[model samples]
Target: MIRKMELKDREAFVAMANEFYHSDAVLHSIPESNIEKTFDELMAGSPYIDGYIFECDGEKAGYSLLSITYSNEAGGLVVWVEEIYILPKFQGRGIGKEYMDFVEEAYKDKAARIRLEVEEENERAIKIYEKKGYRQLDYLQMYKGK
Candidate 1:
């Protein structure tokens, strides 16, 4: 089952977030405090971010976080999916695809597009995204550290 994230699911979500990014050294360890803050922010109605949690067999299994942006160029709401993960133990069982399909159907009338980024080397994720109809963007993603 996929549902909007709630305050009670913070710990599980944080655990998944930390575990999903474990191999990447750049992401900070998500502290309990940070998770609490995130939960509060989401409940407080932040226009910028929203998250969804996936439950399997009555347990929290994974989640996706999205940030919304409006572009005059695009002329509608664009949803940038910053994070999507299903625990390693729970992977390969169609949960990810189910969650994505749910998101697409749920937001079909609201969002213009759902966008996500995967590292060039992450072939597994790339394949899944491509299978879901996401293609490579023509523009390069340039960023600077603060």
Candidate 2:
């Protein structure tokens, strides 16, 4: 089951987020401070971001972070799936697919697109995403952050 993250989920969320950023799934590791800030923003009820905790048999298994933005190209709101990480032991149990379904169902009426970034070398995740009907965009993504 997946549920909106709560204050009580801070510890598990931090642990899992740390593991995720350090794992091969991401290009680089982020400081724990960043994770803490994200948690603070979420708990503060930030409208720009949302976080969810994934549960398996009543146990905390993983978490996802999403951001929302308006996109002229998409002609509406876009839901950016910032991160999704499931513990190694819990993989292949359909949680990833469940997350996709959850996003689709939750935003079908409100969003014009659901987007995410995946490392090219992460074939496991690529396969899952491909099967979910996600396609790659030809435009290069450039970013400038403070």
Candidate 3:
């Protein structure tokens, strides 16, 4: 089942997000401090973000975070899929699609476009996003050092 996230899911969400961010694959876990602050901000109810948690038989299994932003170029709201993940054991079982469908339903009236980024080398994720109708962007995503 997929449902809106609640405060109680914080710890699990953080663990999962850290796992996703800190490693290229599912293993080689990193120390908590590496992602603690960002996780805390999400838990604090960051205004532009909403989280959806996936549950299996009443236990938290995975999560996705969506961030909505207004795009002057699109002339409407755009949804930036900040993060979407399924535990390795739960992947390839249609849960990720369901979670995405849920997001589509949830934002049906609010956005003109939905966007997400995948590592160029991550073929599985690229295929999944393509199957979901996302296309290559005209520009690259660049960042400045902190």
Query: What global local distance difference test value does model 1 have?
Result: 0.78
Candidate 2 lDDT trough over 10 residues, lowest sum: 137-146
TM-scores for all candidates? 0.86, 0.97, 0.84
lDDT of 2 by residue, 99-127 (tens): 99999899999999999999999898889
Candidate 1 C-alpha lDDT tens digits along 1-146: 88898878877887877776665522445566666676678878899889899888887888888888986766788888888888777788898778778878877888888888777777877887789998898888688962
lDDT, candidate 3, 15-133, per-residue tens: 88877866563434556674566556667878687778898767777888788799999889999987788888787778877777888888889898888877777788788778888
Which prediction has the highest lDDT against the true structure?
2
Candidate lDDT (C-alpha), each:
0.78, 0.95, 0.78
Better lDDT candidate (2, 3): 2
lDDT of 3 at 17: 81
The deviation in Å at residue 124 for candidate 3 is 1.6
